[model samples]
Target: MVRKHLLAIGGALGLGLVSAGLAQTIEGLDLGAIQSRAVEQARDAEAFLSAVSDRGKDARDEARQTVDESLAAVKAIDPTKLPKVGEAGAIDLDEMVSGAQGSLDNPRSAPLFIAFASLSMPEDSLKQMIADVHKAGGVVVFRGLPGNNGRMFAAAMRRVVSQDASGNVAIDPRLFRAFDIKAVPTYVAVSTGFTPCDDFACKSRVPPFDRVTGNVTVQYALESLAQAKGPGAPVAGAALANLVRHD
Candidate 1:
């Protein structure tokens, strides 16, 4: 049975009616009792607000802890010990290129990653960017939970990608700092694999990488990086070829 508290709504109305009745019946009806009740209601409202604030803070704390655990798990992986690109029984490059969902959880890293924020791009643009990144076999990284709330972040991500495309999404601010990404929609391609370090202060000694900041298509970014023959040229070239083949 759904219990409804009479004291919550009807009780307040009844009190108001009683006060009105008393005021009509008594020649000198002082409103001290009504005033006291009003003050109590005000205090109850304040207490309710405080409780809500505390719950929100607890939710944020939990979300932050979850992100931290994910970061630590990813960092503990040793990329150097994994098989190389061409080694047998190792990760299949073709498979990764075709379906890179859950790249955040996968031990094998993608050739490129897209730094993104739901608030930074228009709704249509953000959806298109996520689809494009998925097609290009690249991961899309968000800095953290939106409003530091997990539910809000999940809702925002769901609005961007469909269920199938959700796997390519990840949440980690370290990648943003690692690539020196000052703005959203930044692209980074790394020639060597990624093995995130635990220490935030220490600069990760990673292989050559190419970075571009703008609102450009993943294909365009890859083509530009490959054409420049920069540190990420090799990886970008491969990713571009795979994207073309899949398209």
Candidate 2:
């Protein structure tokens, strides 16, 4: 009886975690729907546990198979193989500043910005955009793991890096919320000494910045920002000059 209960609990928990991970894998995915499905799955797991007493091997086998598959999928992602600046999936802002074209006493003093993107975008376009951002000393930020698995993220990143050798990729979901980014390939050039808050709901005061959203090239976006003469204009202008000089 204890063994049966343990199995049921483990199966239910695994299903819930897997469901959450799967939902997060997709860009702009809805978690509410995934949570509802997870709840239904938990109910199904309970039903399977009850069915066990009635000699219902079919239900038990099906539930076990599902749990096994889900676990396998989650295990497939290996974070070790993914390219990281300091820690796996976490960006080291200090390193990002050092490799950047401009010199700054404090890492945050530079008008560091993020190019919000996703792995779901077109391969050629994504690669080109990454290359452009790298040239401009901007970081490419992904909201989360591709397919909610580290192995898949690593594999996808390897393909992108192979073409552009863009090593400034970072995975941070908070930036999405902080910047209120609703679309992919959005370019945000923030003012100097600007720092995002740790809490998503905190709504800390964000420094002045210029933003461009669309499928436009980074050069076009920077030109628009520089012309706007916003708080981020000088930084954007400098980056634009670097891009042009290199071109």
Candidate 3:
């Protein structure tokens, strides 16, 4: 009877071990529903990332197009409105002084004179002189000198006269002549008929001082002219003398 009881006990322990093993196997298996849900979540995340990337690309394309359009608009602006050389701008003394004729019928309308050794005068001084002439209701004619300073002097005159729009000053090389120009940088004032005159004379009257030095400053000449009395004399001789001295 004892042997029969031992066999039954061993059989019962073997059946309990088999049932534990089967329970462990069932717990390890993956459910189809859980796997399907995980795949759907992964697909949603991928779609969200793709949409963000596409939006960024679209924004970049729009920005590029906007920049291109802006550049095109700038390029399309009209260039004619800008100032150009040789346009109907202010008259330059250099260009005008050339090809000038001494017989410019309208003397009072515009002052004309043949500059002797014009290149000897400084550009600033010449410009100032031209401005003075303009202020005195006259135009200037810059005649070319035989020396190398001709072009340089004319250029200086051009720089100053170009600032005014009235075209009051002009330069003309054609007016240059080999006359007895006793004084260099001589300024011969003219009247309504364009006739040349000195301090005391307009129509063949003798100048008070006939022998003026070529190197004499404008101040010296004006002072001498102020002391004399005649036609073509300085309008306000004393005032002009004072102005030249101070200048």
Q: Which model scores highest in TM-score? A: 2
Q: Give the worst 10-residue stretch by lDDT in candidate 3.
A: 10-19
TM-scores, each model vs. reference: 0.54, 0.56, 0.37
Q: Over the stretch 158-195, how does candidate 1's per-residue lDDT look in tens digits?
A: 45655345556655444555676678787788878875
Per-residue lDDT over 1-247 for candidate 3, one digit per residue giving the tens place of the 0 to 100 score: 2222112111111100000111111111112222223343233223323333444765434433432332223223222332243422233222231111112222222232222335456766665665564444434444332222323332333355444422544433222222244445665432223333211101322222222235444445444444555444544364354455555
What is each predicted model's overall lDDT from 0 to 1?
Answer: 0.47, 0.53, 0.33
TM-score (C-alpha, index-matched) for candidate 3: 0.37
Q: Which tens-of-lDDT digit does each residue in 127-221 have in candidate 2? A: 77877887787777776544434345445655564322334565444466667889998998887755444221223356777899999898999
| Per-candidate total of colliding backbone pairs | 1, 1, 8
Which pairs of residues collide in candidate 3? 96-171, 97-171, 97-172, 98-171, 98-172, 98-173, 100-172, 111-139
Best by lDDT: 2
Q: How far is 223's C-alpha from truth in model 3 (Å)?
A: 3.5
Q: Indicate whether candidate 1 or candidate 3 has the larger TM-score.
A: 1
**For candidate 2, what is the lDDT?**
0.53
